[model samples]
Target: MVGRFTRGLRVVDDSVDVFRDNPRLAILPLLSLLSIGGAFAIVLGTALRYGAVSSVLTSDLLQYAAIFVAIAVSSSVGTFFNAAVVHCAFQYFDGKETSVRGGLAAAWQVRRKIALWSVTAATLGTVLYIIDENFGALGSLARVLFDLAWGLLTFFVIPVLVLEDTKGLRPLLQESGTAFRETWGESITASLGISFVFFPVGVIGLSVLGWAYLFASGVPALLIGSAGFIVLVAAMVAAQVLGMVARTALYRYAVADEKVGPCAGRNPETIFPSD
Candidate 1:
């Protein structure tokens, strides 16, 4: 676990440098977040129309169905945006100017793949969520373990969907899982390293923002504090974008066995150690 954590940190460090080197790439994730928010708002608003949220929450079938559908639609939108991010990241990695238009266009070109992958991801996500909502002590453990397993297997699915010459879902998923198993530590460490980097930053930012919000009793001060919240949220989005790039770097290394992101002059093999 310690070694895996170290691997994850290396990915994290490299990701930070990549984002710093290509600050413009942050625009892709920012746009993705806006798209996701808009898409989810529409989907969720439609779902809420089925019945009152209180009623939906209480009825087992209605609640589960509502939540599942909402999750699936939201996940699909997220997957779509993520594929766009992958395209932009790869383009930037290869020494090209990344464009939002081209990224979205490429994502549209492969919409079917995004939808199929979203089905798999959303199903797993909804099931794990349901497991937590419905079960007891055992269910919590199951949810955690299931999430961990799913994370490992699908970590590179978006990148594969974008970069690999594969044509079908079966091969994409199978190849991603195989690669993940062979380079498990890198994936975990990447996740761990990202969390490690973000946890404190998030806490500190939110804490400071919260204090500012508390002290701002006047309307103008309150507006300033609200803007601070927006900054905090934007920072969080940047952190997420950083993680996605880091994950993509690891995927590139795992698949191509080459220098990537922050690890650019170093030995690529060290980044994807099996043991």
Candidate 2:
């Protein structure tokens, strides 16, 4: 019942500290982004060139199936790097030496688990999206609520999967759900606070960059858009990294019964203070 926003912010600060301690941990996420984006572009280009779009637009089955595959791939890649980040963060928390390559190697060792979990998660996610797309207003609202709950419940799944390779999706999901049930306040605030702080900045920066399209010709407009996109992506990457690191710190505290880092040293109530 310790739902303190201030405590959550402190957890966030601890995560930033971890990132500062080992900035290379963030590189895996960047690579993950590039890989996912490349896969998406390849699929889209192939689909368009081969007239898959003709069927996709007309057939619900095709559309939903395509959505499932794309999301599954993207989730798998994203989860891979996120798990990698968690592993690296653990090293940071332990005061052990680690690198992005080492983290990637650890994550690679459990690639199959990551893929399985990603598929399971992606299936649920795709179903939610389909419901939202087809069910009109009610589906949209349901999707919003469902997505939030799903995110909360599975927030620790990647870290769990990385740390405990023997555990299957069911056990990992259960552990993730249980961890959040116990530390819901700190977990929710860590992510929510970051989003609340960065979303506006991203919006404002994009708006300024978007304005370039109005006044600049051709290449300048492209440059402005690309610059804006990079900034936005960088913000998102930072947010995800911080959240994952905080979650790592929490996981160690909650499950491992070890409160070694700054993140765990702080009280839960202070993270998001009632005041």
Q: Judged by TM-score, which candidate is best?
A: 2
Candidate 2 local lDDT, 1-275, one digit each (tens): 33444555666677778788888876888898899999989988999899888899999888888888988998889888988898888887777898988888988999988888878877988899888988999999999998888888887887788887556777888988887776676667777766766677688667757787677779888888778777777777888788788788777766765764545655654544423
Give the per-residue Cα lDDT of candidate 2 at 34: 91
Compute the lDDT of residue 83 as modeled in candidate 1: 76
> Over the stretch 1-275, how does candidate 1's per-residue lDDT look in tens digits?
67666767776777777677767666666776777778778766876787467777678877767666766776777667777777877887888887778878878888888877777766777787778878987889999998877777777887888777787778987989977875676666667777877777677767767877677678766776677667666677667777678767767777777656755776645755656
Model 1 regions lying over 4 Å from their true place: 1-10, 42-51, 208-216, 220-224, 271-274
- After superposing candidate 2, which stretches have Cα over 4 Å from the reference? 1-5, 218-223, 262-264, 269-275
With candidate 2 superimposed using the best TM-score fit, by how many Å does residue 198's alpha carbon deviate from the native? 2.2
What lDDT is reached at residue 72 by model 2?
A: 90
The per-model lDDT (C-alpha) reads: 0.73, 0.79
> Under the 3 Å rule for N, CA and C atoms, how many clashes does model 2 have?
11
Q: How far in Å is the alpha carbon of 263 misplaced in model 2?
A: 1.7
- Model 1 TM-score, all chains together: 0.84
Counting clashing residue pairs in each candidate, in order, gives: 2, 11
